[model samples]
Target: MAECAFDFEVLALDGTPLPLSQWRGKVLLVVNVASKCGFTPQYAGLEALWRAYGPRGLVVLGFPCDQFGHQEPGDADEIRTFCTLHYDVTFPLAAKVEVNGKGAHPLWIWLKRQKGGVLGIDAIKWNFTKFLIGRDGQVLQRHAPTDRPESLARDIEAALA
Candidate 1:
């Protein structure tokens, strides 16, 4: 089993392999995203965070997930187009993934094991669940789906510092 965030591998929206090790020495906000969720608007704030802190060693990674209410039923191409046209999201986006159950992505499994959910539950309750990983590849915190991206600025700043 992987001991840290950098030990995992994910797929990009284009179906390219993306190793978390490539983001060594940078703070990462890993999110399970969905295009049709009510929290979908959070993409703007996520993009803002990316643009605001990117030069300072912060990277926001979005992983489109379909496990929550089938909210992200779109395929890779459709997801890419929706994000670009609606949110103008510029941060890196991963291919559609399952964030819960046995089919969950490895990175997510590690994240849940590391931080768990509110009250120590391991299951992700909904889309937009966020995991904040430090530059050292350790998970710093897990934010609830209702937590706005902007609300995470303080912790992100601290992690970057």
Candidate 2:
């Protein structure tokens, strides 16, 4: 396994290479998101967390994934538009990625290994699964799809401190 979260590189929604190394010292909330999922409204709380704690070094990265039920079937542009128009999300969003199975993104593979979900399962169960990374680039926690972003405030604040 990689030493830290910074050991991987992913692509931005615009197709630009985004190395997690750039966010080395920042607390990161990495989430696998989908526009059409039942948990889609969590975007608002995520954006709220970003806006509220961004200046203090919190970076919420949304990774659009279509692996679950084809909930996020849109292209990068459509995903971006939906997030902006519906949730007014301003945080950085990566291009579509596979969070499970053979085609999973490398970063996600690392994350799952770092902090497995319920019953120690490495596979991501659904859309909106969240991974919180500490400022030191270590995986801190794994949140299930049902866990709301707002519910994570205390943990986020602790990580920032």
Q: What is the lDDT of every predicted structure here?
A: 0.94, 0.95
lDDT of 1: 0.94
Indicate the TM-score of model 2. Answer: 0.98
In candidate 2, which residue pairs clash? Answer: none
lDDT of 2 by residue, 1-70 (tens): 6799988889999999999999889999999999999999999999999999999999999999999999
Instruction: State every prediction's TM-score relative to the real structure.
Output: 0.98, 0.98
Clashes (backbone N, CA, C under 3 Å), per candidate, total 0, 0
Per-residue alpha-carbon lDDT of model 1 for 42-74, expressed as tens digits? Answer: 999999999999999999999999888889999
